[model samples]
Target: MTTTRRPGAYHCGIDAAMDVIGGKWKVLILWALDERARRFGELRRLLPGITEKVLASHLRELETAKIVRREEFEEVPPRVEYSLTPRGVALNEALAPLGAWGREHVIGGTAVTPGG
Candidate 1:
């Protein structure tokens, strides 16, 4: 898989991080796998509005980045599952405060409309 995320080219840690997860779906994918391993169909159900192509691409990128692990089981019909790696767990944990802030300021708390 060819990517522009070269080594030593990032200006900061966040820059490098964003290069791996710089999309609308990657972070959501990470969050979905935070609890337990899930099959492709399960992940699709968990995250609504994500196209199959985008989900497949993000899964590939995350796997390449070592943030997600994919396992294939040998059974009647090939079974595959996706789960978060340790690094992914750490990334999710780091984003906890941001989630809390969003919940407080945007979701459960006051609804701040723009240009109000």
Candidate 2:
């Protein structure tokens, strides 16, 4: 899917940042790929609730954004792996505070329910 930028859509840095990592699954996908490279199946396993279609779509978007690097190897059986680029690593770092806030306020509070 292609997104057309509206006039004056992103007026600030936060708006631009949110545009890249706006969806529910993108940040989780980035978190999963933070430590090391993973195959498609591996990502599916790591992110239990995510459907295969959503995973693939998020990965393609991340690759397009230059946040994830997809490497394809030539072998008898084709191999592909996804890893975080420098920008992605920086994004992970940037999100750390938000994660901590969620854990401290949201998770610790009784208002939000925890899930598998």
Judging by lDDT against the true structure, name the best candidate.
1
**What is each predicted model's overall lDDT from 0 to 1?**
0.89, 0.87
lDDT of 1 by residue, 34-100 (tens): 8899999999999999988878988998998899999999997999999999999999998888888
Model 2: residues with Cα > 4 Å off, grouped in runs:
1-8, 109-111, 114-116
Candidate 2 yields a Cα-based lDDT of 0.87
Give the distance in Å from residue 112's predicted Cα in candidate 1 to where it truly belongs: 4.2
Q: Ten residues in a row with the worst lDDT in model 1?
A: 1-10
Off by over 4 Å in 1: 1-3, 112-116
lDDT of 1 at 66: 93
TM-scores for all candidates: the values are 0.89, 0.87
